[model samples]
Target: MASGDAGVLRQVQALFGVGTVVGMTDAELLGRFLTRHGDAAEVAFEAIVRRHGPMVLRVCRDVLGDPHAAEDACQATFLVLARKAGGIGGRERLGNWLYGVAYRTALKARAGAARRRRHEQKAAEMVPEAQAKERNRHDFAPVLHEEIGRLPERFRAPVVLCHLEGLSYAAAAGHLRVTEGTVRGRLARARVLLRDRLGRRGVAPAAGLGALASSRNALAVPAPLIEGTVRAAMQIVTGRVAPAGAVSAAVATLTQEVLRAMTMMRLKGITTGLLFIGGLVSGAGWLTHHALADRPEGQQEGQKAVPAVEVPDRDEGDRRVILGTWTTEIVIPRAVDGEPQPPLRLEETWVITGDRIVTAQDEEALKVGAVHESVYRYTLDPDVTPKAIDLTEPGWGTFPGIYELDGDQLRISYGVGERPTEFTHDDQRGPFLKTLKRVSPDPRPVTPLFATAPGGSWAIHPDDPGGATDKLTSTIGGVVLLTEDSPDGSLQVTLAHPVDPGAGPRPEYRAVAFDEDRRRYLLEPTLGGTGGSARGGVRVSLQRFRMDPEVLPEEEIAYLGVEIVTPGALLMEADRAFERAEAAGVEVLPPPRVGEPFEFALTTMDGEVVRSEDLRGKVVLIDCWASWCSPCMAKMPGLKALHERHDGGFEIVGVCFDKDAEKAKEAIESLGMTWPQVLVPDDEEVRRLWSEGSMIDGLPRLLVLDRRGVLRVDCAPEEVEEQVVRLLGEPGQPKP
Candidate 1:
């Protein structure tokens, strides 16, 4: 490709002006640059650097915070690209791809910097940059950045490519190897979550955050940094580089995985030939195994291989044990539309062999046609406390669960992501648990029931007859119902909760049923709610619908009644469940309460200790807020107004929840908040108190206190002034 480029360069120069590179596509320019190694190569490389330098700098700056570090990271990023230029295909969106590499590079740099600071005995800090104008700007930027970093890699990669790098949706999708629609949906969901979180913190979503996230705020790369990067790139091309001390600082920072991804992107023409050869060489047996390998799926790669556990030799007694079908109850303690929901009795039938365990819905599940069955190849370690069991499913990966076996009853619990260490079912710490009792003899074969059963309108009844089931609405087959094949070779049924099409997808009840398990058609249905603010704030009803197929024929019923799990109910129940689990010594959030003694020592942004006891005998207004909270920032003017209005009688103390202390300090100084504010410490106790306590689920919360050091009123940002006035007027011991 680079054999004869001097003549081509001269011809291209004659055809187009120096500035006419703008008219040429990235692919065309890249092609020219690849073929020409002398002056033409330099010009093409310069143009590419100039075009993408600002974006690369912006990403590094956002992640690294320090300007010096950002510049170094930026140069290193471009250098890596230059070294891999031959591998980067002409059709690839080099700019977006560089953004991803920059992100990982910046992260690695930050981690290294943190380790250095930790290891250094003496503080090497110098100028504090107190007067830096840029430091004081973008108060919410830190919060936005932290949240973006916390996003799952799948979503984060797209966001970084599209928003930070300014790539179009299609371009971003291509770079990430996903469909454009998938990119759009993920971005939409991510934005909703960000908006909801920001709103909860009292920050308005429109506070230039959306604009700043895009490339519109790209910071220019300094002349020296660009020059240094170009020099480094040239050196790298000539193979004149040495490894630095740490592994992170090595010249070739790109991992083999990243190199493979780059190769895939560029290997368009020869992909088929390469794949055929690569496949044959790698082995057809390995390919066949991987073809059936379960998909590693999660919000992140939460799926991990469970170590192969060797079980004891099977005996007659062991084979007979846990062989029959069983049933259990599942209850999701959530609140729908501010109302608590009743416990749901969910049943499941288990069929166990020497080394296999299969679960399906009982005969009662047939009322709702679709049910999901799960089959697992399990190895049980009976000797351990809370007997450990490793289950491997064909296409869904493996999970580690705990089980307790008795003569006739068995209890099992499993979690979604990690292995369950305990056998509890709390919302936070506990995994989903099932308690099953073996039936005396297997019932009739359920396969015949599926064939002979009359199909029509059928009512769905909960096992718990006493619970309220009025709000649920069920239908046989329509927009409301969907059925698919379960992983366990049973029918998977999903009964949708009645929802306004405008609100988007909410929660629905799912059931798994086996056509025939042993002698009975196993069916088990569970009821729960699953909507959140992501679907907007529209609240729906949570009512359980009665379904009794035994009493009335399926044709007799005009419509079926199924439980509708509302979002509000789900959220409420989740809190209650978490609290319950925590009380049982589970590692859940610690719930804080109002009217409790307000005691604690906090260091102000200026590094001064301010204890609650020290502020005794004064009318204190404790402000809980964060920089990312748009509403919190909006209320700042009003807070400042209040502080100025009643400085003598009232004392305002701000508690900032910003993860970055520098960002919090800057926001406070920029807003001109004279009141003493303390950055909230990231301790477990503090985190739990804030998360579980109703006093701080959302930000911009104001707590008013009397001079006697007793809690007065817990009010919203808008109502703080009125509440303070009332507290000030009270006849409690006046400030001495």
Candidate 2:
């Protein structure tokens, strides 16, 4: 051992007494190490090292000939054990588990070393004859370890305990909680299996493989190595040292690779079983018959069928005239059971290609979000009366409609779940009409600028109220900006207040267009309340424009301002004041601290009022979501599953930021969101909660509250269930 390792060994021995946990089992030692803190935990972990360190080192050394690399792999094996102690199954057979981990870690280290060597040397270089022979002599060690690790648990446990650890059959049986005869039989069968596997790889094994076991048992593990491993593992688990800092980078990388491989193995097994079950369900004869019955008329069995409404000869002139990019803002009239409901303002875009017309609304855009891109396709029939069109979505069936194109303007009228006859907006229940303006003669490619735009809190400065020639020093409220690339080559910019949500007027801008020559970004503001609805007919304009500096400094600040339109509207012109705000850099508010009281009172869809105080006895999960946020909708199933698992002990309150209450209600019912929901923009209390907490920065934001109504965790959608489970296990009394 090295001098540094010797010194560490002496220090660890003096600090922790190995005799304190002399008689503990592997499971007992792991339990103590996980549950205890400080000296007690170190002592427990040290004992585990002393017991299994020799076997693990032997396995690593056999796989990797280099002594230093073997030691690194051994330490990484123990590190993985420390990190995954709680989730490890079959704890009693921990030696077997460690054997597998050690073998895999050694393999990873060997591959990495080989890669480094190849990179450092020239391609023409080759190993000498003597060196190649020596390498070939030891090639069976890795193969031997691989076969042993692949054995089923019933056979592997005895082999690992007896042959690898140098335990007698009786001792191995005792450790496995089985009879000695069973251990002897399993070991005999394991050796026969190993010999056959080795023979297939062109390496004949010695009879019984007893010589191999004796050699491994004779190789003594250095005390300093064990001591150093234990110290590093303790520091890592206690958060005193990160895994990478505690060990060499190669070892850390090897450890992570092994862990990822193990997780993938488990997932693969689960996926295979699910696939088998799915195959069984899909193979049912009656299901196939039912599927065939739904095929289009005049379609023969196993023959492809074209769409029933497909035109034989396409109208080249009509298709060419409509092939470009177009955009529109329209109000969708909505009602439920003949009751007049609030209308939904929708911003839509269409990109018509030679064969298909791609249409996307604000809601459909939200469904794809940033992680995915989807387009709704439509087949146009310019030959029919009023120019028929049929829109088709993947999950939704086709809807028949009519369209008319005149110069740079286009109009379309369509209905959901039915076909429309005429182009009119008078019948609220029959057809929805929209008028769109052409943005480009040819389909324009989505600019990379939107994909690379800076996001976060940006300081805002309106035009100087004093009407001074120079820029103003004072500022109004700041805007928290988030930008995403839409599939139709447009930028979706979401604007909100970074601090004091209710202090200023919140404007919603759904899509943005950039002008290259003038170095200006045009934002078309959707006229609506902050809750996502417009009461009157929709209007489109170049409402907001930003002048970006030609060369941005290191801080990445850009000047933004809105052109003066309606005086009392959300946006106004301020060219000079906007330049001042850009020089000030970005301003981000401090996030709300944990354990802060998150108080709110809002009415649910059932007309029953719910308050934070009333939910004091149960763990509460406040889900801030909107119907137009696709990522939020994707998270609903997991939230519903969490609610079902802890129904009585936990509660979820959804703060819906949808403009239309009826639409929110429809989404809630469709997604089986049985939890109480409060619609925003209509409720002042919910709006105050959003503004005060500064939680409008993103969608699908989850705030977990303890039984005492104190915020315990503020997390994303994926982390909600884990935090909820942990908080549910804690005890807290209701606040008086």
* Candidate topping lDDT: 2
What would you estimate as the lDDT of candidate 1? Answer: 0.53
Candidate 1: regions farther than 4 A off: 1-20, 121-162, 165-190, 193-215, 240-373, 376-736
| Candidate 1 per-residue C-alpha lDDT over 1-736 given as tens digits, one digit per residue, 9 for 90 to 100 | 3323543464367446443465555566667666766555656666677777888788778677788887777777777676676665323456645665666566666766776888878754555676354454445555565555444333455666677767788876665455676677667756765675567666678753554565556787766555556555655555545234312343245333333444443453144334432332322211211111111111111222222223335564434565555656543344222235564444665656556554545444532323334446677777777777776654334557888878788887865446688777643233657788877433212121121111111223221111111111223212133332222222234454333445354433322221111111213443445453213333333322222333331112222222222333333333554555456543332223356555555668788977768877777888889999999999999989988888887888888889888899889889999988877666756565445433355777777777766676777787988888777787856574
How does candidate 1 fare on TM-score? 0.34
For each of the candidates, the C-alpha root-mean-square deviation to the true structure, in angstroms, is: 28.0, 27.1
Error of 2 at 233 (Å): 1.1
Give one digit per residue, the lDDT tens place, for model 2 in 373-430.
1234577788888898776533224556798999999888866545678887533233
**TM-score, every prediction:** 0.34, 0.37
lDDT of 2: 0.58
What lDDT is reached at residue 530 by model 2?
Answer: 34
